[model samples]
Target: MLSQSELLQFSRHIILPEIDIQGQEAIKSSHVLIIGLGGLGSPAAMYLAAAGVGEMTVVDNDLVETSNLQRQIIHQTNTVGKSKTESARAAIESLSPYTKVNTISEKASREVLGQFNSSNLTLALDCTDNFESRFLINEWSVANQIPLVSATAVAFSGQLAVFNRKQEDACYHCLYSNMDLPEGDCTDQGILSPVVGTMGSLQATEALKLILELEQPNGSFLLKYESLKTTFQKFKVPKDPNCSVCS
Candidate 1:
């Protein structure tokens, strides 16, 4: 049940015809697990928590290095040596105290991911940079019949998609077919700060739409954006039958 303060805090969302008290309450009861604490995860975590997500679990093995200050907005110079997960937690706490934040300061491996139960986690966000971790999360999410919202950003571009195992929707592996990525992360190939922020913010928006069960129609979809232009392209993503992970 939402308190009077919660209702007041989310009054703007409640005022929307599509999202009233019920939708805000739904958001307050959802638990989302996010992988990675870098460029993409930073904005996604902050927005989701600020929007009143009930619980958020952030998984990242990296620390706040000086080099990451350019695009990793969640961490500050004072936290250069601190773990990314801890820094993300502190940022969320300041925004919304009602939202619970969980930190996993270790790399997300198959073994580590196996510890999470689908019943406890309503959704999983793939903000990891590597293809291995991304595919692993996709496989685990599909195997557990959970929903996975994945996003990738690098070099002034990004991709976002939603996969649901329960509905037999295409998983991340279905979209990529394999775990082989051509290039490395932003550290190797530089990324614009606004590009990463744009992708991360959209990922958070998708999570909120799913949690609130918004009226808008959403299927296997892909959104691509480039920094060169203000326009974004959207396409209907079909499941790849040859996908080893989902098919």
Candidate 2:
């Protein structure tokens, strides 16, 4: 049950027909795992906390660097050199003290992810930058039948996708099977600040929809953003029948 203070804090959310009191309650009961604390994770974590997700476990071994301030908005100038997980946790707590924030100041190793199965995790958000981390998170999500919302942004381009392990959803490996493909990084490719912000915000949006059981993106569709052209495109991502992870 929402307290009087919580009701007032989330009055806007409770007013929505799709996200009434019941939905707000679900949001307050859900546990979301956020893997990464870089450009994408920053906004995603902030918004999820702001939306009242009851428990959030953020995983990241990296530290805030001065270069990250341009896009990693969750960390401040004073937080540079501090662990990203700590910095992000502080930011989330500042936004919503009611939301419980847990920090894992380490890489999302298989052992770390193995501990969070579907029984405990409500959803997993892949905000990591590299393909390896994305693949590992996808594998864990598929194995445990947990819904996964993944997003990436680099070089003015961003991509967002939702993989519903409960349904006939396409897993990440279905779309990118070739692990050898070059992975883009902000340091090398130069990403626009708002591009990641847009993607991260969308990731949080999809997560809320999933938690609320609202109209969510079909698992087979991929949303791509091109900042240069200011265009958003949606394409069907067919499931690979032989996908090792989801098959």
Task: Give the candidate number with the greatest lDDT.
Answer: 2
**Model 2, stretches more than 4 Å misplaced?**
178-182
Candidate 2 on 73-140: residue-level lDDT in tens? 99999999999999998899999998998899999989999989988999999998888888888888
What lDDT tens digits, residue by residue, belong to model 1 across residues 170-200?
A: 7777777754556877878899998998888
Q: Name the 10 consecutive residues with the lowest summed lDDT in model 1.
A: 212-221
lDDT, model 1, position 54: 92
Return the TM-score for each candidate structure: 0.94, 0.97
**Residue 200's lDDT in candidate 1:** 88
- Residue 134 accuracy (lDDT) in model 1: 86
What's the true lDDT of residue 176 in model 2? 90
